[model samples]
Target: MTVLATPHPTGHPGYSETLPREPESAAVARRLVRTALAAWGLEEHIDDAMVVITELVSNAVEYGRLASIRVVVTRPAKHRVRLGVVDRSRTVPMMRTDSNGDRIRGRGLVLVDSLTERWGTDLHQWGKQVWGELKCEPPR
Candidate 1:
């Protein structure tokens, strides 16, 4: 159980969880994302967050060479949510493009790119962390 103490601008604590590297981890990640975001009253962003979480976890399980994956969902400021997926692989993710036709694979990051405000990666000693940020206005 890894704990990330992210200090939000409004002093709200974030959500964090670590799960084994398995095919089923993506579903667990999505559930966690939904639950956490709902707790934060960010229902409007749940769909996007679930999609991003699935992609990140799938990539990690397929390519990441680690026993566990860590997910962190945070709101650094108002109207913004940041989702991070950490795995034990240093290989950076590439968004592939097939000019000739639509490929079945490699579209995960494409969906993420189109949905999020911004997305990027960070390398650590053990592996890399892929993250995305979404800007959403919560319902009043």
Candidate 2:
């Protein structure tokens, strides 16, 4: 796997890793999110960010094409962090409105929707990137 830890031109830190498309990759993705948030002093957002990344990574692992997936964590603004999962699949994630407490599946996107300030997919010719943003005040 390849990992990149660098600060963007805007001066905010960003992290990304390419991992095999498997269920176990979610743990690595969560660690990446936690590490980035800690470095930025944005620990308050870690819990939600963890959930967001896990769900995104899980979906990519389950449905994405190709052999690997990319996990990204970026501080797009001083008060906001963005987490994303990129997969070689065009499938768009959808929130199941009919999901209930009894169902074991189909609630990932719902949880993501509740935790994130905003979340969406960026489509590309080769694949799509599903991302979510968490908003928090910069630590003093």
Candidate 3:
């Protein structure tokens, strides 16, 4: 697992980690998000960010079938944090709306839509990157 915690020139701080496509990697990604949020003095966003990252990471691990997945957490502005996951699979994620209220699966993007300020995916030659942004206020 290669982890990057370098300081960004913008002074907002950035972190990234590569995890294997294993079930345990989801927990690892959440931990990395907590650490990054703490370092940036943005602990208030921890819960939301963790949830978003967990969904993205789980999707990558379960659907991507790649050797490794990359997770990144960044604060692009004072009141915003972005969580993104890059995977080897090119299949874009679609938000499933017909969960029928009690299904045990297919609610990840619905949760994301309700929780995030904005979310979307980017497709590239290699694969796709899914990202979610949270508009958070600093801890009092």
Can you give the lDDT of residue 22 in candidate 1?
92
How much is 13 displaced in model 1, in angstroms? 6.2
Give the best candidate by TM-score.
2
* lDDT (tens digit, per residue) of candidate 3 on 1-140: 66677564223238888888887998999999898788767788898888899888878888885799888888787778888999988999988888468777777888888889999999989999899998877777
lDDT of 2 by residue, 8-118 (tens): 422333888999999999999998889887777778888888889999999999999899999988878767788999999998988888847797977899999999999
Please give the lDDT score at residue 136 for candidate 3. 73
Q: Give the TM-score of candidate 2.
A: 0.92
Q: Which residues of candidate 2, in runs, are more than 4 Å off?
A: 7-13
Candidate 1 global TM-score: 0.87
Clashes of 3: 0
The numbered model that scores best in lDDT is 2
Candidate 3 yields a Cα-based lDDT of: 0.83
Model 3 misplaced stretches (Cα beyond 4 Å): 8-13, 100-102
1 or 3: which has the higher lDDT?
3
Per-model TM values vs. the true structure: 0.87, 0.92, 0.89
Model 1 C-alpha RMSD vs. true structure (Å) is 2.7
**lDDT to native, each model:** 0.82, 0.86, 0.83
